[model samples]
Target: MSDFFEALPGAVGSPPQHYGNPLGEQKILVDGSAVVDLGHRGIVTVSGSDRLTWLDSLTSQSIAGLQPGDSGETLQLDINGRLEYAIRVVDDGDTAWLLVDADEAAGLLAWLSKMRFMLRVELADRSADFATIGSLGTPAIEAAAPNGVPLVWHDPWSSVVRGGHQYAQVAEHPGAEWSYSETLVAPSALAAASALPVAGTLALDALRIAAWRPRLATEADEKTIPHELDWLRSAVHLTKGCYRGQETVAKVHNLGHPPRRLVMLHIDGSDGVLPAPGDPVAVHDASDIADAAIGTVTSSALHYELGPIALAVIKRGTEHDAELAILSDGIRIAAAQEVIVPRDAGAEANVPRLPRLGAVRR
Candidate 1:
């Protein structure tokens, strides 16, 4: 057994293991815990004289309300109010850090820079200078950390401070008992720090699916408005002033109902294989596929706790708990709807309606 697994009590006796493939010889030893190399997650540093004000004007969240030690979630949307990127912002005195999914960082940075030609804010890609790890449901191991590391307790999840400067983001799930912690560390000392069992991108995907957390470039589509993805409560500040996409955001929330809704998929064990992202999800009525395609699968994972699950965006009013099928590469996978929220409920009726824009689309 590896030292990392050995350090875990009782884990060495009967370590959880999973086969990478049904017919593959190699097996992945599950330690009941795993560390994800979040190197792919990128960080953006916004500093200079007007960092806070500048960011506040651009993002969907209220930046001025943030305190020195606090963190908040925000989204950057295009002029049409389509979500471009989602970020977790942490404030530390004069500088604020924006952490975003790895794939969307470059595009988001470029867009922000273009709008920052004369602004006092400076934007730099600090992804290469930092390391991040996400640990879930393993409080015992985190509680055993040495005192030297700066640890921040945000209720359900705690972050171990690594490197010279550290910042942590913690949040509790609204309807679930799960807790998540995201820790940012300086790249220089990351390799030497005590290792946590590493979880591959696959494991993280499964965890997110089970949690029903929506992500950008996947669960969120180019046609998706923030309200449709149910991101307003956490990602957007409705009270905040004008932004690139505020008008559309408000309109959708108030007057218009989002054409699509985020849904969870419970895949049947009898299916031959799980569908990948971008696969078309449809309703199977006896012998024929439904005429109207329901939605697209964004992320799919084999959950450690819930077997096979996926997060998808389906048309609103679709029947919950109804059996469906996901098709990809001539293979049909069986799926069922698991609604995250009912169609007509809290916050849906109160969203502000779009103001008249006089012939021109805002």
Candidate 2:
């Protein structure tokens, strides 16, 4: 656990999620000054002269133009184009700071180390050396950015990145005003945040779910594609030169459809129970929970402002206007979908006179 988490008054434990005053602390986070200990988060550093270009050539985002203190994010895909890793990054001239989920850090570090063949890059897991402090507003996190290796990854969920596309056609994305940041802090800085009331993932998730932000830790499945969650808005640079799995990314965006789409659900929380991740979400066609589920909850939370909300990845074939329900704690909670990635997303939408679904195969 991070030192800051240890200093939290009611921090029960770590992993899976943290414990603290979620609803109460959420207010502190939004009202200008609360520091959150990112317990299950991990840190990795890549240092060398070839760092920028090397990373630029490897991931989904264009990192060649990275400058000192600049924040960005990227994804590592398998040769088959499946999402293998996701990272939040910031460069400090000499090194690249990568913040990721704790469970995935070893895999990311090992993969980076093994891929360093001829490149001058050096990879190190700095999870033990440094911790992360999160805040929705700048007041608390700004003061904790490491002085020597100062780096803060400001989230880009709000706007489209250069060379990337947005699948969300709404005039104003709820995330457009999203002002979240994660600051890298060492032991001393962690201690500095001790006085700040602590909160758990619930508080952070409420805001994130409301914004329709997809996270690597919670939203990933083996078959996950970046387009499914509209991650291109921040993580994938479409026109960037070749990298692993670029072909699939380009093909899907330009000529195919994402098999699944992301949606935000307003759950009926009258029963006072929040569905956890992995809960089955079904189309409310017949009120029976036994029917095959259409999707799975990626993350859920009881928002202080919005009652209850969740992000779910559902089959794209599911109708956009379909009523949905999540079966939880022996009760089905009714849900309404707020599209994040529209049902008819992708370049295929513009294609006309196409044959039936399996015509070519036949």
Deviation from truth (RMSD, Å), model 2: 3.2
What lDDT tens digits, residue by residue, belong to model 1 across residues 1-362?
A: 12333243333121222213311111121333544445557778787878888888988877766666567767888899998888787766666777787767787789889989787888889776656555554322332112233222221112211111111112443224335555665544444332544444565556556656677757876787776666764677766789999888777665666677877888986755877898888886634443446878888877666677888888777776678888767677788877764464223347576768686665
Candidate 1 weakest ten by summed lDDT? 160-169
Q: Model 1 segments beyond 4 Å from truth?
A: 1-34, 137-175, 286-292, 345-362
TM-scores for the candidates: 0.75, 0.92
Per-residue alpha-carbon lDDT of candidate 2 for residues 1-362, written as tens digits (9 for 90 to 100): 46546645566655213455678867877775866678778888899999989888889999989988889989999987789999899988889988898888999999888888998888999888777778787765433344355678899887998888899989999998688898776666666566665666667778888888999889989999999999999999988899999998998998888999999999997888888899899998756754778889999988888888999999999888899989887888889998888877887446576688778755
TM-score for candidate 1, please give it.
Answer: 0.75
User: What are the clash counts of all predictions, listed in order?
Assistant: 3, 0
In order, what is each prediction's RMSD in angstroms?
A: 8.7, 3.2
On a 0 to 100 scale, what is the lDDT of residue 39 in model 1? 52
